[model samples]
Target: MKPLALTFLSASIIALTACGGGDDNAENLTTEQVLSLARNTNSANQNYPDSATNELLMKTPEAVTYYLGDGVLRWSTETQIPLYFVSIDGANPPQTLIDGVAQLESRLGDIFTDFKLLTWDVQQYRDTNASDENMGNDTFDKAFFMAQNNLSEGGMILSIDSGYYDKQYSNNAQNMCANSSIAPFSGALQILWDKTGYTYSKENLIWTNMGNNHGCKWNTQTVMHELAHGMGMYQHFEPQFGSWSDGAFDVLATLYHNAPGTKWADLQVSTL
Candidate 1:
């Protein structure tokens, strides 16, 4: 349920802001800049100075809703792409990734609806190692499932393709593009690189090493990030809009959240 003429309306509104208006939210582009007045924490970077109360920033404007869930994107409408999530093993629940999906559907019913989850109570989905050679094939399997269900070209699926999303999957929609025919949003999809090991995960959060040193705890964040790409972020190349170290939230990073010590504000459902 996409908004009515949302593209045209937003474009005109953005043009007005360029000419100047009451766009206060447009002022601070960096998280550090966001909390310039608040006393901050030892930053992940000198310039970023990670703040306790800092509003987590993103790489894309669409990411705002992506990372923050449907509740946080200020201008989000009642329309959204109905996503069919592929809950693989590594990115499962009680760990935040899978739990976050249900939460989003439960809370942000306006933008997302029609929730269906695959319960692998017996045989857990494969949690591929970070270096699996068949990573691409695994993603293709999920794509095949969607195809079997007759998922329309416009529908979306969370493809835990290989750790790197540089390959094309033919008619499958992934959130790896900056203006890509697929997702196009900068921060749309996360090609997880085991934040623990600091390298790309062949499973891309689709598999878990039982909480050893696998990936970031924010699995759901990655899901929404890619969803934003499908929603049309169109760009993730802004040098100044990623980390406060990089600068501020842009279309790319906006797909995820950065709030500290709290997942509440990050997972609320009203904004999606």
Candidate 2:
């Protein structure tokens, strides 16, 4: 766990030469006291409960209909979840990269049986906020970034960072493949693609010189993995799924039922 990044608004008070104009109660408290009171009031209003979808999952039985993001927890026949690709590096993603994501969209039905491929609407954009090149690595920084750049509700962001001297990913000469975070307040998930050049092979899902390999093995699979994290499959290991299995075995394990061939279902209920 790292330190949370927070932007504290500076509290100030102007001394008035005339004493009778201000409210008597405000005059009694110091500037620090006033700020403390305001922050306490705000904190008291926050609800710590998990999102509704998460609550339902906790109380309901295992089902094939579960989803991975806080906003897009369950796919609806009537509506599609909006998925946005944000270029935090300020470089527009090439067509090959875009095509890879499209392929994933095509395969969602096969991957998630009850989920409809049509339930997700997709788009790409150059981020209006700071690029990944300048963003901080902590949870609060990531949360603030999403708050500034995210476009809509039930919307997920796939962010691309320029991977240069990133404190979280690029330390010790390492390149982060990708990372993700969910907003505690909103349950929206943001997937961060870091470092490694954006160069990709002509074929879809193959990134040359990117994310720990030239091919970026199972590019779609990796996206699904990170998306699962955003959706609340927070655990990092499972004996049935493999050492570093993304807990896909728990909820959507049926999709890959034969692989690793362990009869495990819904790690969410069992573990959490």
Candidate 3:
């Protein structure tokens, strides 16, 4: 979400391990079978949305996306996961974050295709803190972002290169709001560069961190990952959703769930 369009965070650090919880041989099955299950997104007919409602749908993210192997985005009423972002690095609007949002917007059509992403500015709570001169040039207030965004208990916020750890703000990113749950969305975080730059993680984001070579596809992954979070799949391809490890099948996987040499991951989960 910061100015730098290309990003580098960590994803491989948390190698997702599959337990015997879902299927015993599910892991050992041929790539084809796995691909099929992952692509499924319940292709049931969605009632024609009213023109007014459809106009609004054009603004929000989708449960499934065309770029995500042809799955439509879906959400259940009971589950409302909100993600907020705090920009502290003087980055009013993160270009990289914008690119990611746009990539998804492209595939889903002009409706939600080009919706304006969420963003807002806020200041630290403590009046003295906000006005303090010696608090260093690295002052940040996560609580303000939360309150501005109406963050709830389970709500999440994305860090658009807020320079969180530049000083004491590291803890701020760790805890977006007071007692609120927050997670970082980043990619492969190399140590040396991070020391000179910023730390990144793949858990919170889905973008590929190829250093100087991040854009388009890199941003695409971010869109997929963030949107998945918007849905209900919080973890990366967890086995809890029976035969749902396939990214295309599960809202979480998306682009990262593809095979090494394949152009686009197979998202035909039990094709309807």
Candidate 4:
């Protein structure tokens, strides 16, 4: 991956330094203040796992619980999971994507009393010269850009863009709708939507595939699947309802049945 742009890093340092005293006095800061500093600093450094920096910035138990734990990082449902909708290179997010998120928010609200999914902001990035040869890099570029601009602090970024063809799945690009990291790294997560994939629609908030004859199509379930990854559901398990031949079982269903606790990583049980 390319290094985060130097100018962005410089600007981030300047912006964060303005927030409070430097790292030497971080212990005196409140949990929220320290979280803000750590998040911005991690974003500027491209979200790589940095135990040393995390230890330095996160002094409070609340901050440590929110950003670090025994296993993969998971979002605490006690606070709202901010979702930032991003359109890259002028490719507007599809209506389906918007509706799907609303549906997710509703379902999650019903599932957890304190957990809320908030539509924090809608943003646009003008990467007019982005190339398909490195689509994953491009996705991270948009993520880092949003992070540096302070638009996605301690949030999940969902970016919609056209012309993304994952080379690893080149033969089935049309069937691949979207992708996301399995969990938050450095207190943030990212999701990339491929505008060229299967057409999606919703009826009664249940997403259905309306395009493509092969592979799984993009739908609300797909969003949930990818978002499950963002929420730290990493492993794929056997389908509960139907055979994989029909693309019936999804990560979301598995998560729904297995997630009985507040911690998402707890879903990694022997049942799956």
What's the TM-score of each model vs. the native? Answer: 0.33, 0.34, 0.31, 0.41
The number of residue pairs in model 3 that clash at the backbone is 24
* Overall local distance difference test of candidate 4: 0.31
Cα RMSD (Å) per model?
Answer: 17.0, 21.3, 17.1, 17.2
Q: List model 1 lDDT by residue over 1-272, tens digit each.
A: 32111011111111111110011223334443333211111111123223521243333222121121112122122344444444344232343435434544444344544443432221222234533211222333434444555554233434332122222321222222111111211112333222222222222212211111123122444443323323323222222211111122232233223222222234311111
Question: Against the unseen true structure, what C-alpha lDDT does each candidate score?
Answer: 0.27, 0.28, 0.29, 0.31
> Candidate 3: what lDDT?
0.29
User: Residue 124 of candidate 4: its Cα lDDT?
Assistant: 23
lDDT of 3 by residue, 1-84 (tens): 521211211123222111011221223334464454334322111232344344433542221111122332222122222334
Question: What is the descending TM-score order?
Answer: 4, 2, 1, 3
- In lDDT terms, which candidate is top? 4
Locate the minimum summed-lDDT window of 10 residues in model 1: 14-23
**Residue 169's lDDT in candidate 3:** 33
Off by over 4 Å in 4: 1-73, 88-93, 110-134, 137-144, 162-164, 182-217, 240-272
Highest TM-score: give the candidate number: 4
* Model 2 lDDT-worst window of ten: 13-22
